[model samples]
Target: MKARDLIVLVGVIGIVLMMVLPLPKMLLDILLIINISMALMILLIAMNTKEALEFSIFPAILLITTLFRIALNVSSTKLILGEGDAGEVIKTFGEWVSQGNIAIGLVVFLILVVVQFIVITKGSERVAEVAARFTLDAMPGKQMAIDADLNAGLINEQQAKERREKIESEADFYGAMDGASKFVKGDAIASIVILIINLVGGFIIGMAMHGMPFKDAANTYSILSIGDGLVSQIPALLISTAAGLIVTRSATKGNLAEDLSTQMLAYPKLLYIVAGTIAMLGLFTPITVMSTLPFAAILAYAGYRMQQNLEQKAVSEEQLEEEQQIEEVRSPESVINLLQVDPIEFEFGYGLIPLADVQQGGDLLDRIIMIRRQCALELGLVVPVIRIRDNIQLKPNEYIIKIKGNIVARGELLLNHYLAMSPGYDDDSVTGIETMEPAFGLPALWVDEAMKERAEVSGYTVVDPPSVVATHLTEIIKKHAHELIGRQETKGLVETVKEQHPAIVEELIPNLMNIGDVQKVLANLLREKISIRDLVTIFETLADYGTYTKDPDILTEYVRQALARQITQQYSIPGETLRVITVGPTLEKKIADSVQQNEQGSYLAMDPGTTQQVFQRFQEQIGRLVQSGYQPIVLASPGIRMYLRQLMERTMQDIPVLSYNELEPNVEIQSVGVVNV
Candidate 1:
């Protein structure tokens, strides 16, 4: 072990030895001096510490010091009863400090006990107990504040972690102090009992064993015992005062001395009042003028000087602020910093501010977080943090969602009203203003709060204003999630995969296909509203077919076929036939024939008129399937699926176009409609 550690270990062992083994007079004196010195050191350190957490080891120190003092008491009691001379320190305290009077020494020792045990120890224990309770109660709030700061970008992850750890430490420190205070209380009680035992036992031993008379033995042993008690109680009192200071200390940027000087003497007016009071007392009361004049004069002069210093400090601070503002204006980088844009922004009008404000019972921020988590689970992509702010240019009840600084969706809401939409059946009985749902463009009405129950009873889905906005925002993010996935996000996903399947990642990344190629493939899947949550299967498919082609679209198709079960489960209901629209033999043949290949890539080479005709027929078929109450999914051959999807993307973005190979074997496919040309 290191020297410091060995010394500490030896010191602890020595404390144990003091209780059991008798020591020489010189050694006992040395230990007594050391105990006094250690207690003073602890008191000074506690006073200087700015925060309790800075002295987190204080509880253990308190325990060790209490034991050390107790051991000293034991040794002193043994010597006084056995040999009539405990040590020079104790004998000198008895003879010189107490004026050779046993009664005087006993009174002094009892006063110290009362001050340490009744005043300092009792108060410190109460404060520590209450502080520990308050700290524990406020822990959840402190943790939430840290989380809020982290979410608002006020602090980074590491800083948040540090703050959380500090909070836990503060709780633990106060709790330990609460228990450690009891040790001090016990030590005080033990001191009183030990003193009685020392005096009684010493008197008995002096008369019976050493042949001394009753009065002589009483005086001699009582003086020594009171001296030892005073010696121990003085340090205990100092240590108790230190414990009180520590537990009651508030968190500040400076030590106790600095805080007291700065705060207590902050105002010169208070000192002026004190000076006036002292002068008034001297004149009116029977106090001599000479006695109080100097003190009053000193107070008046100090107050005047403090007032001057305060003015000068204010002037200096103003000048510094002005200089800082001028420098900020002169720096070109300050102007350039304003050009930065957020990845996703949510702008609401003034009236809609209450929807985002927590004080008004709005949980829009929390809902947005849940939306991001839901998207990550369903779409397998991390949604960017949505920055919400108020924009006065829009209508009072209007809000908009922006992706990369461009508005993608806008909606209007009535804060006090609920949006109610019919579930396919017509319900005109509920009276309200007619509107359209921004998310799906479905016909909806803004109904009164009193009409919510009636509307729901009428087979209409009822939603609040915040839920309306949240639903709209959720849809917009899912639709544009592909654009949110950049190279950095792709790298994070690769690293995440690498953590679990390192061999697969090493074999595929930068060897067969780079990160960009993998990103494109993932983006393509996301663009089709496919979940990339099964990244292991995705990477394995890429590694197998990536050697043949570097095209992201082709790679996406391979990945989709590999994830056939997931894709099938996504669209089809369990134990039910999958109703879909299909392309006829003639149209399929035409689409297959139109497929062409070049050095760049394979693409559709069909004429515009024929493509238009095919799209019209496909739309008609989809409309018929929708009218029959079946959600339409187009199933095409593998060769023409991508081309057909590209043709219909602009018009039928919601309808998924899947290839035949993408379907699972156990799922039954029922052809509800077919496109003919």
Candidate 2:
């Protein structure tokens, strides 16, 4: 057992000793033992643990056991007035009782017992309340994971049964505590009735013990000690025991047991102190305070203090709420102002062509050309031309080159199986991956050249690429892994993450099952082809139809093949030479905003070369739309308006810049028919 438990055992023994011995002589020992036990118990129980059973049972058992022991020793004869040597001691006790000392003793005993009972019942109810609140806001993903686990045959029926049982047991246990909320009203009446019974019993018993003739009139001083000690000790013990039992029975299985044992061991210290002090007062001094009156005054003072503290706590809470409101009002602006460059300027990309400025379009390609003209009109510079390459499977050389290039730059260039399986290069050749290396090196060299030119030119520009850093990946892993991964990986990864990914270890994420990088790359490919439902269905089948965990990589490649066929059909762009005219600031802002809002951080600034790559991504999305049997077209960013003007000027530059006020008469009418101008 714990040291606190040991201390409680000592206290119990000491209390038993005090009751058996003469009261005044052993009182100090009793008080000392009780106080030590109470302190130790409180300290031990206050430490948070997975199982929280200390609150309810401890108070009940401790107070009741102490009270019961004390009650057995309580006698009316101890308070009777007499004229003899033993009678002198009795007279002294009577005088103490006549004074307020006995009342102090009685109230102390009663309060300890009543409070214990309240703590037990109320504490249990409080735990239930907390559990209910916790369950209410639990996410749908948590339930979904449980369902997935069941379907996957992870946990057996018995284990599931036990889990439900535990949940229900906790619920019912707390429900019982709600009934205990009514016990406070019962305690008030019980206390009053006990007081009356004790007073009447004490009067009769004291008269008989003192060997005095039964008088109808009461000896107020002599009967007072008897009334105080009897009522306080016996009734208090009964109430505490009753409360403990009620709370214990009502609480979840095993809840009350721990708390009861603890309380049974701890609370008697207060009683011991009160008992010792009252005994000391009787022995050492002559007293004149009224017993019941002092008790009543103490009770009133305690009530007042409780009320004051409660009011203060409420006021503190209100002030904290007001402070939070004030902080919230300023926080958003503070976050905005903290950045030196305007966030809005960064949100909108530099360029896109709007269609209104375009002269004419007769086909799908012509329509795209019109969009290009619109972007030139809106932004001052040449529009960056995007050429989409849909469903182009990466050769092994391409994968190796991308991988090596990414490694040099401390980044990852992930490739799906279609790329690995592509028959563009023979693996037997020296530096088989060397052919892939050129794809990235050429871009890097172009970026370097552009950077140098931009330094020389006033309006030099380039596009930015996507930011896929370790920090972002860590966050995704923590959130999605729980939903995606199964038991073995979950158990292993949880520990691995704690050691390696300390930043993300605590995050509750969606599980991702066993398929790793291969699956991610495969999904990216499928994202370009299949509709969302088809992709979800394919993954479900891969998990259910075949052996999944052993070779997820191969399964990933297979899925990518199905995705590749769809990709080649819808958006196959055929081109080699690409042209790009970098756009100006105003249109850049508008386009960037559109991308930020619509896509999930997919668009990032890059070179005119990177624009071609972005078009490829767009082609995949458009392909998915087409295969799903929808006519798909990229919505030109607003920045395209400026670019359209340039395109028109190259074809026919005589037209003036159109104003919003002149749209109906100047631009729209001219496009519809011959204009008077």
Candidate 3:
């Protein structure tokens, strides 16, 4: 065993032995001073711990210290009664606290008992019990979140395991603390009992055995009892306070002093208010000027200094940013850097800067964070960090959205105005500048504050500038989501699946298919606005069919059939019949025959005349579906579904095309219209 380990084992045994052994005055005094010093060290260590887990051994330490103090008490009691004196340590404590008055010393010792036992110990015990219960209750939820992140490719297997372990440690620590607190409580009660016995027993012994008078016996024993109690109880008080600090400590980046100063003195304005209030007390109240003036001046000085520091910090950050930009422009690798592109980018003109600037009340940045979370939940796609910047070449109110460094959509906004779409019919009184809502291309007007309330009352959909921008950006991302995912992103998803469902990934990847093949399959599903969130089922389907075919198109069809329930839920109402446009016998037969195969893959080889005919018929059916307020879903047979989708993908990319096999058996499908040539 290690020396440190052996020393700890021996020290615990020695603490127990100290209760039975008799000691000389000098040796006893050394032990008593060591007891006080250890207690102070424990308190300092507790104060410096950033979290309770950082001091996980505190419960064991608490038990050992309580035992040590109890042993010291028993030894002192024996010495005071048998020898008529404990030690120089006890005698000095007795004399110093009493100052020749035993009654005052008794009062002081009782007060320490009340503070440690009733206040600190009781509070610490209750806190430990509550913290233990809460930590256990949160365990399942924390574990589920870890699994979710692992599946989402947000964290690796090792990270998830570490997080789970930390949660367990938290529960165990608090539970141990709950039980160890009783030791301190029992020690407090024992200290009071021991003090009473020492005083009473010593008095009787002094008169009966030593032949002393009542006055002399009482005087001699009272000082010894008070002194013993004071020495023991003071250290007990310190240990109990340390226990409270450990139980109440939460996870923080810094120690107690740093957290207290950083959080409490965070707001300079609050400090200024406090200083002014203290100054007013001196000016108008009965409090003396000298008493309040010094404190008020100190507070005022602190606030002023804090404000200056904040301004200096802002200036330093701006200078640093400017220097970095200049260095980047001057470097030879600047051209290489320019070749890289962000997955998504949002650039706005000067007039719309406030929409991204936090100080100007812009919540655009916060909304984008929510947007990423929403996309992750809905589409099972991890949207990258959106690079936002200002473009000087654009108009003042103009903003553009980009995908892979190419501009995809642009819109203008008046930040102070609301975009109000009309309620089927226009109200003559509600008026502003005419415009178009960019997301859906609906006719709308930019109305100021005065017209906003009136428009809402008139049944118009009133939306602020930020909401307009957010809605447009969300739609753009959803439309172009397929372009954002690639082989690297697919590897992340594959690795995530390997953490939990290893068998499926190992069977399919490298042997039957590779990362690029999987990426294509996922992109194909996302192109039609299908969610890839249920990756387990998707991987299972791929593993079952990947050996038979290498085509992503064929593989996506198989995967879609596996996710029939999810796809059905996406398009079908709970009880209502699914209304769709069905391909007629003539179109299906033509599409089936037009599907030609080659070395690369299959292609629709229909002539222009037949293709134009099919397009016109589709337009007629889709227009009617839109007029009737039904989504335009093209339902076709399984064999020709892929071909039919390929024919219309370029012109009607937003519309969903479903195969009959993709629908659930329970859903009732009604063909509202049929398309044929």
- Relative to the true structure, how large is the alpha-carbon lDDT of every model? 0.91, 0.38, 0.92
- Per-model TM values vs. the true structure: 0.63, 0.30, 0.63
Q: After superposition, how far is residue 558 of candidate 2 from its true place, in Å?
A: 18
In candidate 1, which residue ranges exceed 4 Å CA deviation?
1-46, 49-101, 110-331, 596-600
Residue 418, candidate 2: Cα error in Å is 34
Q: Please list the Cα RMSD from the true structure of every candidate, rounded to 1 decimal place.
A: 11.0, 23.4, 8.0
lDDT of 2 by residue, 305-374 (tens): 6556667878999999999978976787757654543101101011111111244321323444554464
**TM-score of model number 3:** 0.63
Better of 2 and 3 by TM-score: 3
Report the lDDT tens digits of candidate 3 across residue range 411-481: 99998899999988999999999999999999999999999999999999999999898899889988998
Residue 324 lDDT (model 2): 91
Candidate 1, residue 15: Cα displacement in angstroms equals 22
lDDT at position 657, candidate 2: 23
Model 1 Cα lDDT, one tens digit per residue, 387-439: 99999999999898899999998989999999999899877678898999999
Mark the 10 consecutive residues where model 3 has the least summed lDDT.
Answer: 19-28
